[model samples]
Target chain A: MFQWSKDHLLLLWLRLAASVCAAILLLVAGFVLLEAFEALRDIGPVRFAADASWHPASEADQGLYNLVPMLSATLFATLGAVLLAGPLGIASALFCQFYAPAWVAQLQRRIIGLLSGIPSVVYGFWGLVVLVPLIRLQAPPGPSLLAGILILAIMIVPTVALIAESSLAAVPEAYLLGANALGISRVGIIFRVAIPAARSGLLTAVILGAGRAIGETMAILMVCGNVVAVPESVFAPVRTLTANIALEMAYAMGDHRSALFVTGVVLLVMVVGLVAVTASFATETTHAESTHG
Target chain B: MARGMVQTSGVSPMTRQPRQRHARWLDGTVRAVVGLCVAAVVGVFCWIVGDLLLVGVPELSWGFLVEAPIDSGRSGGIAPILVSTLAILAVCLGVSLPLGTSAALLLSELAATDVRLVRVVRRSLDVLAGVPSIVFGLFGNAFFCVALGLGFSILSGGLTLACMVLPILIRATEEGLRSVPSDYRHAAAALGITRTRTIWKVLLPAALPGLVVGLVLGIGRAVAETAALIFTSGYVARIPTSLLDSGRSLSLHIYDLSMNVAGGEPKAYASALVLLMLLLGLISMALSISDRWLSRRMVHT
Candidate 1:
């Protein structure tokens, strides 16, 4: 009876299941690699990387698949959004975690929850009705990097703010008390002690915000006015890899479509690599904070 | 004599000077700046939601919600869109929960010594989690729809979403499982319970809250999904009788409506509103259940 048990049965199945799991992992990698090879074959590595123009449908377009402008545009938009939303998110998080009265903290938490809950489509709609015209009037062109950046930045704020707040809250109350006892001002304590103590978590929040910005499609598409050229200026319309994929996916045929999927694959690889790096940094920081500090 | 008496005496509370008016002004200014920063973040949320509700409500009518995509808004109901949404949700849950939980169980119970396998699984999940919805839509369309002959059905889209949400679910389940104290396992083992039985009976209940949270987040992601389903699930403006049928989700419906794809703006706005309501309802239930579970956990603990 003991030999006929659940643990024994599970052990019997584990080897089979583990191999299947490994195969499933290979499936995604295989899918991405096959598609990527097709893209390279069509465009070649040199032309694809060096050419800064991406005109899929233009009659007179040279075969330049220069993704530099689009790549920069994506990076700039993400960077711009972080610049706009990151500090403000951190400040609000500080206020929530430390300075705010209890009721205010609860209210702020609730507000952040609600804000994060709003769907991405709704964010795009809001950008469509409000930001699009606003950008057109203020900027040189209607849908430029600035417009996309601003909207994307807005989308990332709640993400950064909420995560930062939670991490800040996780900081041991003892550190703050010690800083206070040393006659450190409130602001100084926050800047010097609290923030540093929660550095790893805060970094994670920022990285997550960056991830959100890069992955975002609809809102950026609505406002970026994807022109598929290297962004000459901040106010110039340019295509992001994400927007490029979304715009072309529906109508693209044969190589045109497969090419778009390859674009997605590239974006995925880039994002995954970056996130891994960020996580490594965060891990080191957390270890340093816990074991060393 | 006067200096000694006055200086050595305890200082009067009243001797301290009031802050200069300039300092006061600076304090007020600094406070205002801080207040504005706080308001700036909060204000955006208010304005966006306010705009949505205001713009969407005027067109929010029984006709818009019930009616399907009509050329001149004469006919078409979101009933079909609603049905498709439910179908996708059901399939998403079914696919993701098992895959996520099984992987999590392995991480918790087995593979205890193999750091390489653990690292690989974690990275795979992380990569999967970070892939954008647009990318998911692309691969999902290719693998499931074209290659496998699932053919633009709810199953294809739902399966894609499952992949999308699997990482999140696994992370949540792992956190939940990690929270299960060693004492419980020891207690079970002391009674000579099988490891699998101990995990099934003791650990799962203990980690239910985190698991619930992960499930909630998964549902939220699945519900709001647009891009992946857009490619694989062809825009059929009908209620799906089964998961096998190609369908349109509420998110897709809203996108089509907003983009005036089928030239149904008002109806799209209504669908957006409906989508918001459904999502909010799911969120509240998830929260309450998690909350209740936590409370019960506290009592039992």
Candidate 2:
């Protein structure tokens, strides 16, 4: 009886420990909402839709807190990163899985792992030193949306390639063998049979990559010129919502502080949405796999 | 006559030769293209590492690691920053290890009985993992610093890091536990072993590689973090007297030097090289440990 009771106590301890996860989620959401409440109430949510500039001030009447430019910059940068990294990631995954010899495959895997492990700040530093100068030769001002996109693409290529490679690996050997027996060319089999089989996984990889690109802060902040205006072209300098909060939160007060929280709220919502979508896709992939099996 | 007619039909070898050649050409082109993509990725990796080594290595010396910075981090060494970084890492891992392991146990062991609870916890982890680090910085600032009255100190910074790393640690450890073969559990039960003993003796040891990998990865993330640390940790460069004292992290130092301070590039590069080398050492250690463990398991099985 005592042993059983001790086991129960241990289980209870584990349960309490596990509740920290839920507590953290609630605490983060609650605090963000509570802090952002002032801004949301005063700004009326319509201000975010207003295409005006973001000029936060301590005084109530003087400040104009519109997030349009930053929001659009964030979206445009993420889109550019996805477009650039997606094909390259998928193609690299294919090569690693299908075409590479054993040593090459092993080396590629190690490289991808190391690439992902590199700190974001390092990437930002490299961009600031090397990439910015390279771009400045072509465009006078170096730090621009193009710089941010290129850095972000490099940062997320590992994520996309890792997931893509796994999904490609999960494609059943039977499908490949059957396609080969049917006299289809190697490339035809890969494109028509293997890729189609791993379509949902590829989609998941891209979406997750997009999520990472969107949330990334330091690397982009260093590269993307933090000029709070709508970018005219890839070369035009721009600021993202994340960079805005990081730059101003140090000294913000009163309404200005609340505005930053509101920015956080918006970011939290977007990230949560992406997580939900990725979860749904994950379930769909599992369901498909179960049915296939 | 019939044989001659069949040979001249629509699917004859005369027409098939061209299509076969076309398919082969397409195959060759794709092979070359994907190979080039792979080469490009590897080349980028090499370039980044090479650049850092070439520039950062020359600045390294024994004095650089042991002395305190002299002029707003333009010269001198990173001793104080190193101490603070280690202290924060200590606090973070000290809090996260037990909590993360227990959480994984709940998910992996007790999951059979509490389906809804498991799902809720899992979803929360997913959301938390996806939340941006800058947002976490804001949350940490509000909750730990302002509300909890920890202020901008190592305690708050470490706690914030703990929260940020929990999801990764839990998921990785849970995966490790799940991958342990069920036969061990059945055999333990058959031998009349208690549940606690089975967990402590059989399960955790088997899952050590996963736990190690998770810990190393968490360390990597925590060490690399700049945005999340800046607000909670503050930018005080002094060696922290206690957990309540504010201190500077290496990543933050690197950032401030490069961006805010003029003529601080060389110091910044040196600091970055130190950080990079530290991370590389941890990763290689983890790889070797996991490799040895895995090989031992294979041999025994």
Candidate 3:
């Protein structure tokens, strides 16, 4: 197999390698699709989408998964994170891009990088120490919609700030200068001219941050206080579809286990939808800016 | 580089911004905000590493890593769990590296023609990348464990993890492959070299640093995974003598320990510190390797 001609050995090897790589992709696609389909099939095609009830020990446990509750939890946590990070993240972005000295800006960006690198589990650990203790004094314990929201919100800031900083970077110097030319106050211009221009991209950053939050698992599992009831209140401990699967999948046998797979299917569909939404906006914003720039 | 820089910096001379907005005070405001943002981020850092160090450091010892699971037979040292994590991590690399690199080569070389199969494969890779780890966990358990009768073992778990890492590797490889200059390809082609020869000698070597980056990211993910491993690896704490044995991981060890530790045991903190240290070592090593390789590559070329 070892040959003197770089052409012979390299060409032959690359060809062989590419085929294997293609095979890798095909194998993964085949396996996951098959597994997902199998899970879907067992859940029954007729009632799969409509099932709302998700009890493991009841007669109608096979009934609807009441997905609205879990969906609400996922959406609520994501939205709550955005709600917390939106104003704060944007202000931080603006501050770093236009206001800070070079050294300060670099330092800020480095901090964001370090924050993003820290594991989500650490966030959960911190939340368990500070937040769970705080929540325990007021409520019974475990897996609350509020707890998930608070933890997710805290975790989402670095993501939001990272993307938001980039969008702020993309704003042309001309807009700020042009607005200033028109006698707009610097604060007014930043609010009116720069932000409005960067609106689509900023929205992309928000959605991107939301994706990081919704996709997160470990911390949410730690603090979400995993009661499976529909979130009657934010403080009521409840399980998202993710927590439900994590809690029960290992021990459940047969149908009980299969139900856990169904929960995963739901989470997957939801995540893909979120990914698509964010991706589309991200491309659209980038495309828009490029053409105009 | 100078020309491109000048071109990007040049803008229409239409803007007469107010001197008021450009006052030195704006500089102060910007500096203050950046400082505050950096402070917030650092605050989060302090909270996590500080809390973990304070809470977890006191109980950490070699004994923690060597002990068996106890406390309702559910909590203990994570020797077996550590072994399982390494075994699965090793297995993922074994499966992913060759296949991922090969795919990267194909994408770089043959991708110019834009074949339908290539497009489909590319999209499939993207979908696979986004398919979520938990879904992979479910699939790995069902198809690998239940169907192949591998049960909950290191091999199947690693196989599933391989699938998880494949997309990341391929994507990284694509970036690496693309970063290779076309002039090198042209020179090799002009020299009557085969396409494959040029790719290996001229391209892959050039892309090695990026490949290393990709590998680091993939390894980070594989090591951190808990959900997928929970299903496919099975959470038994043991020093597995074979790949077929079900075992726990550092994260799973943490999970297993926390759930059953009766909430106040010093051992919980000890093992948590061990797991944290394990992660820190992986990250720091990956960072160092990438840095070293990047600097060497820059120097070599």
Per-candidate DockQ vs. reference: 0.38, 0.51, 0.31
Sliding window of 10 residues with minimal summed lDDT for model 2 chain A:
A51-60
Off by over 4 Å in 1: A1-5, A11-26, A58-64, A139-141, A232-235, A290-293, B1-34, B72-75, B111-116, B288-301
Tens digit of per-residue lDDT, candidate 2, span B1-301: 0000111123555667887778768989998999888888889989988999999999999999899998999999999999999998999999999999999988998898877778888889988988889888999999999999999999888999999999989988998898788898888888877778788999999898889988998998899988888899999988899999998999989888889889999999999899988887776766666667777878877
Which candidate model has the greater DockQ, 1 or 2? 2
Residue B142's lDDT within candidate 1 is 77
Our tally of clashes for model 1 stands at: 9
Residue pairs whose backbone atoms clash in candidate 2:
none
Instruction: List, residue by residue over B67-169, the lDDT tens digit for candidate 3.
Output: 7656532445656667788999999899888878877776767786646646666766755666656677877887789889999999989988988888878
Clashes of 3: 20
How do the predictions measure up, each by TM-score? 0.88, 0.95, 0.82
Best-performing candidate as measured by lDDT: 2
Order candidates by DockQ, high to low: 2, 1, 3
Q: Give the interface RMSD of candidate 1.
A: 8.8
lDDT of 1 by residue, B163-209 (tens): 78888788878877876878888888888877778767898888888
Tell me which of candidates 2 and 3 scores higher on DockQ: 2
lDDT (Cα, tens digit) per residue for candidate 3, span A1-293:
32357645655665666555556545544555565565467666545446656554455455344455666677777787789777667767776776666667666665555555555665665676677878878876644777788778767777778778787777777777777667555455666777887887788778767766766777788788776566777888766666666777767765556666666666666666766776687678779878986
TM-score of chain B of 3: 0.80
- Considering the true interface contacts (CA pairs under 8 Å between chains A and B), give the fraction that model 1 also has: 0.29
TM-score of 3: 0.82
